[model samples]
Target: MRHRHAAAGPRRPRLPLRYLLPSVLLVVVVVMLLLRGYVHSEFLADHRVRPPAPTGTVPEKVLSGGPVLDARGETPVSHRVPDHKIVLTFDDGPDPEWTPKILDKLAQHRAHAVFFVTGTMTARYPELVRRMVEEGHEVGLHTFNHPDLSYQSSARVQRELAQSQLALAGAAGVHTSLFRPPYSSTADALDDRSWPVAREVARRGYITTFIDTDSEDWARPGVDEIVRRAMPERPGQGAVVLMHDSGGDRSQTVAALDRMLPELRAQGYEFPRLTEALGAPGPHSAVHGTDLWKARAFVAAVGVSESAMGVLVVALAVVGVLVVARFALMLLLSAVHARRVRRRRRGRGRDGRRPQVTEPVTVLVPAYNERECITATVRSLAASDHPIEVIVVDDGSTDGTADLVEALGLPGVRVLRQPNAGKAAALNNGLRHASCDLVVMMDGDTVFEPSTVRELVQPFADPDVGAVAGNAKVGNRRRLIGAWQHIEYVMGFNLDRRMYDVLRCMPTIPGAVGAFRREALWRAGGMSDDTLAEDTDVTMALHRHGWRVVYAERARAWTEAPETVKQLWSQRYRWSYGTMQAIWKHRRAVLERGPSGRFGRVGLPLVTLFTVFAPLLAPLIDVFFVYGLVFGPTLRTAAAWCGVLAVQAVCAAYAFRLDRERLTPLLTLPLQQLLYRQLMYVVLMQSWITALTGGRLRWQKLRRTGLLGSAPGALSGSGAEAREPHGLYGPGEAREPRTKSAVG
Candidate 1:
């Protein structure tokens, strides 16, 4: 005999570090992406502040001074580029296409220029920044993300400058003290709004640099126009020329640079670096040690995040296609199944008029510690409209469930006691003693309606049908947890069952209520204990044995669902793992010929795709949903999420309509997706971890409240009726029966 102590209940294992590390890395990548603002374009938008109408709050000397300003002392100092020298400074660059051409043209002319790079681009294409430093060009900070710092707070400005420095340090192992605010042009244009920002930049030890001339290259003006505009008006006058090599098509700027560099040199105006033109010390400083490593790590993380985002985008697309395809298949096939059932009811087809099944069936009630529910279960069976001989196999319940059932003394019900063998073994024992050709199996906690047995057996009228799966409804659905499960049953389970039935690949006959032919059971080698989910294992076996299995939607049974999160987790964990085990056990059928091979090709793949693969990847939708909300466009992200939810709601509404259920329960569908669905995903993930590590799972019995038995009318549309107890003995007056046996 199988003892309860032989195997231990499922225990929580310490999460392996391998799994933990990847999760941590993913979180880090997401954070890096958010910090870099690479997923959104708002940071890169060209924002102009219109010079703010010139205010006296700005220092007149600073406003009218040269492009390079330093205000570290009480008296602000400014210096202009030397006469007959031109400082060519490019903004918004490190562009892989245009920056190189501009750099190459300058190199060909032996001319040096300053390229002010944005932190976003610097981090993304570090090689370009490295190349700028290698080619004897000055690299200055233009603020990270190219934000207009005049409108930003001191803290925001500090962060921008610090991040830019970090990017510079990471890319080329050097940082520059020169800074430029995005959207600022010409020192004379600085007003009260921008003058204070320049003072703050000077206070931070940076030489705030502005332009003396605007090339207007960003407008993609003609190359000749750009070159002409970039030149100083006077022959000997010095100028700091502003142009761009990034932020849009810069081919015009590149051509302009190619013509202007040598032409300016030919005009006796030397194109020198900004610091050289200003006659100041070099601003670039080499980074070392921990700071260098940290900067490099930051850049490495940004690169990884970009790559990971690409992969996630592809995964999201794949999930999108899978979800839409599954929904389409379910909606179409479920309608076909419903229509066929309607036609059968109307007697409109060749095989529509099936004879009513009236033969007595032996119902097996497998009980383990089910004293609270045994009485109502036996009474409900005795009240069945269709004749049934119920064998209540009490599998070593410590609560005296066998004595309680025997005491009830229902006329057609017999109590058989045995040692604490597992549920599958108890089922097999019950099957051995059944005298009826048709057998119905149900859990001890399930309460069937008066007509359930009749409707369940009606499918047997077709000789090829070997088994029928019944509709299992949640009885305690007034609670939130139960309501979520009710929605899942209606949408995820029942609707999928309809589709699977249409495809002739129904994977599971739920243990709550199902019926099978004795010949089919015998041919399939009875219920085996190899898998925790005996019902599913046996169902797959019958398919391989060449017997047809189908769904009986009219045969509805009310069973209590798990009430708490902990209970739900344990129950689903077992179900997930057990289903995987059963699928793995029947894997060989896929390679075989005949009915087994047919089931293997059609049923196995569908089951794997819908049940295993789809759900495993489904979490990516929510993952990216959160990612988009944080780092991407909020309106689009929310709209996409609602679109997916709306599709789910449609499918759920149709499922409820088909099952003749009320739609009020669907109000919690969004919450179910937000919270309840995540728990199920975690359960499935843990199951995968357990399976991959070759961990064993034992049977877990949920704590029942006997709610289904106590209140049969609580479940709507279950067709349940409350019946008074009728038996040979009163509730507590009978002795134990003699039909007990031990199994070895």
Candidate 2:
């Protein structure tokens, strides 16, 4: 045995070098693969999941009435708006190729129909959606994809619903309380998950669709039958007739719509979305059917058909690229603006010295339902170091804002209690009462530093400067939410103000602390009530009249931010929607009104990109990134994505670095990259939708007092904290504080 073993060892000593080399190479390759997988999994895990309820809606009490809906809350309703007045609903589209033809036909016959489109579909054809809105067609949602609601998880169903909701909002400029589930199915099986989904949606204030009739065009019916099915002989009240626009060969359906839309209009059927129906009283007063059946049909039909996911993916990518490019251009513009400022300063030389002041200053504080913060704000104003006269315009605040202001026992702080006109009206009233040469408008919730008035007025020393925008600092930032707002204020609003200064085409002089020449404001006809963004409206007005708006970075105002996400959402929604209204109202200047119209060529475009396209693209990129990581070839994309992400992270970090105290919230920045950022996109899209539909801009008040009383992990309105000052300069120490109260 020993001899045999020795012989075998001798034989092995003659082994080939090739075998040894191959063995070593194979081991190295395996090790590298393992390392790669580990890195990917770790990074993916880090960047994929959202933190515990960092962003969410406040659980509002259900608006009483309407049957409770299912998981995919497509409730059935019996409200018929009359068979002859059949409203044609084309869902899942606004297809560019087909929808335009449909629109032309409808326009030719002076007809209108409701389009309940999928997010995927609308995104692919934003122009078509815009056309629908421009042509006066109602746009609703048919879910993001055509996923069967009955079989999907509640989370999946909600995501789907949100997809369409966001798409219609982002693409078509419409917000509807109505939604239709895929395949006309509802998740109403009394499942534990389904009920919550339904409840959550209803709590968010959406009315579930209840289709009273179906055209069955999705079933490949002949054009004649489709037309016949859609055209009810006596179109009943609240009837939502359904048909498809994008799924497969809808030419026949389109043709059918072309022929039948005019006929139906001739019959006196008013085509209104389920949204309009929800606003008005319907046939059923919220209780004619069982919950399950009610969820199944809600006197509406969402014409849904599937589109290839690829199209949406590509469209989203294109939109995203455009947004990113626009952002880059904006940054460049900011840089250019800074250079121009430098050049102008050098050119002016000794004339840059501050001039002696002879102008009277009137500070207008518009008060809404802000009783809690009104006294503090007014007191701060009274304590200002500058010579000032104060006027507090209470815009029908039921919270006794006027009473509190009147009782403040401060001179020169006169309270003007008016009926519930908008902020625009309040501003106009303030302007009329102002006897000062310089008018400073402030939000009632914001308090100013003593030197703020002086600094704000300094820019007005340059007669060319029509308005001066003061820097806004977060007044309450003790909690994480406040800290988050601190970052937002410093990074988003503050930085933009600086950039705007460089550009000399400032889009807005925030109401929190804005200074304008009394003559300039008067010349512009005060503030236009037609637009919601009064500050932006006046800014545009000044620009249109060949005036320059300057940003006063040194002039600072402190304001409280909404402590809850719901409050934040409501506030932001109003701001965004109002801004859009302002843009639309001033759209005429976008083209060549002349070289004097610098606003249309530069400022207006800047506003559009910053507010609209940036939001649109940011979310789309997030969606694409998620999909690529989840489904694409693994490990390879990691390097590329890391580079892109690195740039983004660096940019974001730099953006907030100016306010170091608030920079800590950047740690949560990565967390938002996972999901919360995407949610923001959804909210932005919804705001756009509501704007397009002419939804009321009336402020929806958020309950704020019980923030600290709630539990942290309660999944409700928890995570609330006590209000306190926070951000770059630390707590409670104002950089400047001034008081002056002079009655006119």
Candidate 3:
């Protein structure tokens, strides 16, 4: 009905250029602004980094140097990638903000410098440490207590250094591999300044830095006097200048930076991170220098020219685009296939001749403590408008389900009783005595339409179709939560049906309303109680045996949805976990040649990537766009982000249009991006861990809302078939000829 109405809507005409010109102009302006921002950020990042360079001619100088391991051998401290370098040193400071202010000034010039931070100051202002790393600055360790090196004992110094290292690691994600001694001068009496501290730092893999130049007035001097004092000694190649950002007001130092940083970067300085300057790849792979190096290496290894490498990168990107396009095309094709199959099956013959088919259906409804709804189930079945033997399996229902069935006295409505075995077990027991050519499985809580049974059974007219699933709609969608679920059901189940129609691989035939051939169900073992997701398990089992499962969208049922966040979470957790379990159980058939192997080349990857990776990628995509906004290389970077966002919006809009929903929820897509989607990760992680540990989890019972709560019709009292001797409680009560029996 919904589909028919959608088709009837007046077609919207395409807008003319006059209508679109403003939009185009707006887009262009946005692109230009983004590009401008990107360029500015790149320039600022390039300019602010530092290690003072050789003065006379080369503005930005690159130098290679390292720690003298034994004052005899240069131990490699950092492995600088070409065009990127790191500067090494200590901070907090000389009990001084002057040290850090000077450091900040160097950073403005785009020079890399390491700050071995004191534990005391780090504790006071850890934000500075975090900002340093976040802004591509390296953090090293100064001592914990920040005592003068000459006054501290060997053991005391070691303890202080260790504590500081641990503190830095814990607070700022920095594991210090370098240390700087206080004052950069050793005391001879105790060898406290160098030997002992050096040994302790070296033992922990720290490369201690020896500063080549000091402004000296760190102890005392006027800002102007200090600038004059420090300006004469021009920095040579790889010169480490000591400075501070904490401990004192160093406004003078800040003043001098306006003169020094840009002048120096303008002089040709490459400010690499300390680690990069010392010749090591930085933490993230996005760093320009490292990516270029890796690309070069890959090209070299493949014996490809630079031009070939460029071609390969372009080819890889193009392939990704092609794959995504193919996937979308395949989805559309599947939808068309499903629609055709449905139309063919549904089309009645001319002259109105009845088709010669007398296959009776045994509809099984499994209920647990569902006395209130059991009557509805029986009444709906009695009203099915098709010949169906309704069997309600009462799985340990302490409620008056049996009493209610006896009172209803409905013909062809039977009640089968069993212990509190799970739904799967109850269904299996009920199936044993089914005694019909076709079987339909449903939940006691659902109420089916009068035409549901007829529509559901229509698909079975084709021998190729083993099972058909009915469209399950939210029976109570007045509340926000239920409405959300209604939308989700339409998107997930409906979308899947379309895809399956094309691929002929239906991953699930929901237990709520699935019709199956009795023989097919028997061939595949009857539902087992082991898996939490019995419906998914059974569907996969049937699919494994080369049976075609289908969707009967017009065969509708109204069922309950979780009404609260907690209930919804619990239901989804079980569902997600169960789906994963079913997938794992049938993993071999995923990509292997067999009756169940259709999904290997396409379906499996699609399912895994879309269901699993898509949620994870959501956060990353968000971060990427935000980063581009904050620190884009050129205005084009911002424009690229807008392009990405625009494309996503279009795709989402198309999906929503296909599903036939109101426009209000479409706006919630971005809100879902902020909160709802993140829940996927939490559920996935939990489900994965549960699977790994083989932990048995109890079924999460969703609390009732009673919003659309109406009592179901009573069940008809019936016992198991005598011929098969399959009773509800146990197998084979008394062997006899198998015949259909609907008894109370």
Candidate 4:
């Protein structure tokens, strides 16, 4: 029965904005992670490069004076720490590992120092920056990203300072006036290249601080050597010492600090913060109001990005393991299944010989608006070598599909007309009218070979066999889009079926070409309209009813594949959603007794993991592939991506060999992975969103070109079976019946 139709209303968009919100959020997270990686890799000074040769650009007094220079006025003035006092300034610091140890040593010796922190490190380890302020240590800006200021524009220099201050305000709620340029040493080392950078710092109201003592602790020198190099040459002569608490192993620096601080204090030397030794006012000013809150938000974003990156790495590892495991299992079990089939064909089964099945079969084709394909479909069934009764169920097609089939007047073919309901309802109607014990179902756009029916029913010779999945090929694979589907069908779908068959937990019998026992269909309540994938739904029902399902590789059918991306997306979105629907509808089978329990435990997990979760996480591989290429080490990144591609190519080649297919189509495998794979990922993700949100999906129909009837050899391995002519009979032409099969 059909439901009453309502008048058409205003058109609604296929995908609502709510359905796309989750994807947009995911993209935001990925972008944040990329930004974090770029900053971490590109910034933060690790080792110093030699400065350029000196030029006449530097002022003579500024170059020959002490380590600290005040250039904010017309004439630059330089100063050193007062006699009997030492100022310890650490660069590239706020390190989570070494900074705490150095601070603890300073506290024990009752000394205070200055930490010149890079903006990147401060943003990452905010607590360390805050502790510096609480412990009475001065914090000075070391610039953000640690770039060579001589090579940067005035605007870039300003941005670097402003960003550093932003991080400081966010972390410690303070702004500082003291600044240190990266890769700087004593004032005497200032060359033509670095002179302008100093002037720019002065224009920005910063007191440029340079170091007089060179510890060289960044090179991991011995602790004793570091302490010796850090000391002033003469007694009562003060100096500003340079050291590091971050970037590589800082154990030597930490150990050197413990020994040097107490010994210097015992010698009547005082270690004071940089400002204290200079007798100047404090450098830091507390932040307030909106500026403080904005800085806090920036810090919070960085923390979230770090946490998201950790989870993405774990997801990447899980996806890698799942992909490798799935490949290994498919290869091993498919070989076993093929070998077993060969042995049975050679009469080597446990019974020594197998029984043959030659009974007539009923083929049901449920079609809606498939007028262009019905003629070829009916003729294909009429040409089968084995006797078969063809029933074309036209489910309220606006086109003249039923009329066209009746006009053909082919022997042993009939047409049934009914109002539009859905595919599952149409299939159930066909099942009610089927006459033979063994029934085969196919789509209106699919064409079968002469031996397809005979080969499909052979598994029924075993009393326990209830359903058989057939090899469905793409018949319009001349285009690149079609070729991609061809590879997927041969490699992904068929190989998986072989593996599942060997495991005795076959999940789905494809609707394009599959045969079923009438008794099994009745036991499973025919087909239900509760899910879009009626075939998968009924197949699970049969498994739960303790019926055996298997695959028949030799039974081949050629079906037209979508040639455009829009059509393909529509088709796949339906499939992905429908599969989820079926999985959810039959989720309880896992805990049942008998065959239901076996399928629930084995088949359900495999389907959920490989079909759902793996694909959801698989996009991370490509995401990181692009990330590595953009960041650095291009050759290594390209090599790693090629390795993953090589694995997939090897598996695809083996699958093609098993299917007796030519390898010409494999030239596009790389492009398929780059482009086609992302489309699938998006489609699967959309399905996940729909399922989680409890959104409803309607049936979508794809337009057919009916190319299989005219060009049967579009794909490889069709053999001699596709040579029959496809011509409609004239109105007066009558074909004699080969078999007098009648419907009960």
Candidate 5:
């Protein structure tokens, strides 16, 4: 539960991940799958290619039936090749290693070859592309970004072709009228579907290219096998041999090139660039400074994207590790707390000293659109055995919340109406008219048990105790969402409260039901509109101002929790974000001495880590699990995921048992993590965003279901026996304190 975007609406938390599910997330997954399929089929699959340096083939009708273009997509303006001549071409590169090495090998063999370049890669390694042009090698276009033109729109195809041309012109100060569609193996391989794209290319005055022979060196097969594959079927055959200078470790290609070029020459074969064999002009486009900078920007953008991806992976791993570590610490600390609580319980018996306080308490009920449950809340408070005064502060609810309270005409209950101020202001208004030194704050949507206030005020018997946090349970927990919330309340909040009790760092006295000494509240500056979680902010202020906060678990109240995911998100976002604000607001307290220093040093970090940072990091576990399912050791990954799940299940089960809740809802914990947990992580992220950006958060109203509806005496009372006959402290016989453990 998180929130604190302090604004008009209860500061709504951006429910980041829940917003992803059932729609936006579906689209993301579909797009990823489509992209993966396209990349795999087009580039990862084995295919034969056309001429290494050829672009689009010339259309016969336009060229008036020029001599047939060869496998390199190069139109032979004149077939001036010798009988023993061979054209060696390398497609898809200007690789730093293999390209230069191939160039060196070619230089050593006194041979030249054409290199078809992908635009992005050419832009990235412009110097290499420049070297190709300067070393008597031809350069051609192989589409920007390397998408298969067969699947691309005409506009996309045009951009791909033109971008490659621009990249070549910028990188090497030259461009060719050559073009090659991605995934091509041979000129003959261009089907009817691709011929139109080829003709479209020809319309732009570019010639297409393909390969007559393939080296298949991208697979890193043995050097000898690559050499064997590159040789033509017959000895001294005149053909275009295709190879790659990039895409993977091309050492075998280099080695094969080292071995084959000499062997081909021994067979009286002459390796020539496609231009030389076809007697075609080697075209080069003029360059400009703007084009060069544009190419530089493209390369820089690619580098940044790669760096960002690496950073994301590292950050996710760090978050996952921290979340795991935090959970382990929670288990450790919770165990220590449980042992201490048990020891204390065993030490205190019926004969132990009993807390007696007969002080008249003032209860504040803050309402907005709570008409449906306001009466029930008043009735429950009216039934408190201890002497009390009830004040209802209505924040101008159009739902007749104030009217219902006044209509009840309940003794000791008064309704005070104010303009539509926020919850914090409403609380402040309640504080203004509260007449008793002891005050209890209750949400209008909550129903307290008869003895809740009596049990709550008992902690004040210790002069040092300034506030008491009551046990808050989910009342509307019938639906799956509500049931999940129920589990969270018992398993997360209450369990943490117990540990916080032992640590004496209880930061929040939940608004649903909390007891505070009037003076303590006043000393803490009462409630402020600065934070949507005024209850939390004020409680932390009390801690820093040297006030002791305790939990009265027996003081149970049923709160009407949000029934739907949307309502839950809004409530929690405010909580998480507001909590962040409060933490930062009181950060300097850590340097102080005494109680404030203790809480600031211990409590603040604990709460921030477990409640805020840990939840934010929790998403990384899911990310890793999903990634592992797709690309890692599946069996080990599943075991590891299940291991974490089992540990959490055990913890939740222990919490539920301690809380005396049924194990039934515990079954939904895993399902809850699938969707509900992500919602929480997103809320925390939104809070951090709010904090970082210093954005205002507004109040978000949730529709009430009046789920905690009950008559004044519907639930059993803890009995008025703990009450004193005369003054609260002048008791004759007082029941000994049962247990200080948080309300389970």
Candidate 6:
């Protein structure tokens, strides 16, 4: 039986214009690529790129460039064949639009015209070539790529003609002894310089063709202008008229033909094919079957190369858009955050400290093969001003991580051990074992500031506040890459956190240091394993469940960032992929009608735009910048790129100011943009591609260096990697931190 509301199934949301536009662009790019070779050889032929020899001026005379001569230096075909008739000749096309229309007009007037098409265009539109031949129109050679023959050697000219012959044979199964050289715009344009090419055509038994009258239709002049240029002023004997069917818009040429053909016939002039008017020897041989197959295969190869170039152009455009948008949005959002920070400071008393909380809280330290910095992290947590119960949950560490914590003998500190589970699973287990109403979680590689736990837990004093996001600083910023990451964390991550706080869609509370109300965590179904970004996933779940999440700027944690590019890629790949997964998992929240809806509609979209769209587009900026440096107005392109860099610098400055960080890293901003920025976009794209392909999203852990320090400048040098701060546990004695597992 059908339910009462069965008729109304949930309607899927429409794809955004951004996605649709790119899809259309991608299709156009693909199609263009398939015709890539054709475009280059034919469309770009007239540009005179890379001629074989120097192009000197060609002058018109008795032996102008176009016509072929016999062994006795006379015309191959007598021009004055018969009076009261004209030979109509066309060149350059077989264009999709104009060629067919021209063919239709000729059929209507019961006339025949010879179409001299370049090899590239013939291969691209073979049907047009076949159709012209089937309709009683003759076909002639116009070279393969249309390079200026005057600048070519005898061999090059021969090769050009042969290729066109093969192309015509393959396309329409005919090998006529007719030829026209490129750059021979008119009979007058050919001169002594063009003799070698004409001789080469004659050597191949071809009657080199030229026109007595030019239509000038390739210029796309108006219909009247074309007719005026093409038609003879008075009736003439055996006049050969030239026109084109391609290369540009040919509407005017078609219109001119429509008017000229009828009027010419009205004056008792008959249109004859070139062979009929000028005469030609009979066919020596039909198109060879082997040559036809070779021609088709050769054209297919050209199409592939064309497609590749087109795809590249489109990709560059997309990346350019992404990069520019990222810079603009970052600047705007960071400025808003920085201004808000200043206003808040002005409103508060000096130092702007919130009242210290005295409540006891449970701290969950989840360790997984983390032996280097676990001691420092636990020590830092133990020294918090507020009373706290430390629960060290070791998720099957081979390095005896739990034993070291238990051996420390700190008061109110306990250890729990479990099989190797992921961070999310370990956290869920820890959450179950904790007894306090408020809980704080920290990564084993992270060391909290003395007052971090206190400030993080303070937000829980209000029943409405469910979780507090802490400021996560890079603890290993001594390397060039590390310094770049420090800048990113302070600017891109922290500043964005401030904005998200104001927007009430705090997407993530970093696992390094975050405080949560235990009941709220339980209400949101504890930690979920659905996304690689477990912290972000859970926080978003809380928002959907109507819990207020805010950033606690005063709460700081020094966490080790990835030190190498390989590590960084792996870490970010997981992070970005997981974030996408979480966003999708909670996608329905956009329609939940309250806080979740606001977050989905507002925060989720913003996250997608910046994280996915912006980064995806960012690389195009560099592609163009590099391209311009090589082949374009270098100074202007550089200035435009620098302008974008300036915007980024301003945003970074504001973000550093808000984080109360030094401006030293700004020195590396240019280098970072050139190198690090591209890497990040690649990581983002690779991760998203992985997600789309349904590849496994595994957890990757960065090797802990245990170099994090509490004071400023501690993360600035190679010396910081000496050892962990061990003086807190004893006097003048330091031992390598150890790890061991326990049942309870």
Highest lDDT, which number? Answer: 4
Candidate with the greatest TM-score versus the true structure: 4
Off by over 4 Å in 1: 1-57, 104-110, 629-632, 710-744
- Residue-level lDDT of model 4, residues 1-744, one tens digit each, is 121122222324456743476468658766777757744644233345556776698889888899988899988999888887989989987898999998998898888999999888888889999999999999999988888788787988998899899888889999998999998899988998888889889988899899889899998779999999999999768999999988879989988988998888888899998889998999999999999999888877777777778888899999999999999898999999999888888999877768878999999999877776777888888878788999999887766779989999998998998887777787888988999999999998888877788888999999899999998888777789988998899889999999999988888889899999999999998988788788888888899999999998878887888989987987887788888888998899988989999999999899999888898788888887877777656689899889989998998998888777788889999988888887788888888877877876655677666555732432332354333224334445433321211110
TM-score of candidate 4 to 2 decimals:
0.93
- Judged by lDDT relative to the true structure, which candidate is superior, 3 or 4? 4
Which digits, one per residue and each the tens of the lDDT, describe model 5 over residues 243-348?
Answer: 8998989988888888988888998988877767776676666666777677555545544444544665676677667656655665677777667545545656
lDDT of each: 0.82, 0.60, 0.57, 0.83, 0.72, 0.73
Please give the distance, in angstroms, between residue 413's alpha carbon in candidate 5 and its true position after superposition.
Answer: 4.6
Per-model TM-score, in order, reads 0.90, 0.53, 0.53, 0.93, 0.69, 0.77
Over the full model, what C-alpha lDDT does candidate 1 score relative to the true structure? 0.82
Of the pair 2 and 5, which is ahead by lDDT?
A: 5
| Model 2 misplaced regions, further than 4 Å | 1-310, 330-350, 356-358, 634-642, 657-662, 702-744
Model 4 CA deviation exceeding 4 Å by range? 1-15, 43-50, 710-744
Supply the global lDDT for candidate 3: 0.57
Q: Higher TM-score: candidate 3 or 5?
A: 5
Ranking 1 against 3 by lDDT, winner: 1
| Candidate 3 least-lDDT 10 residues | 718-727
> Least accurate stretch of 10 residues (summed lDDT) in model 6?
1-10
**On a 0 to 1 TM-score scale, where does candidate 2 land against the true structure?**
0.53
Ranking by lDDT: 4, 1, 6, 5, 2, 3
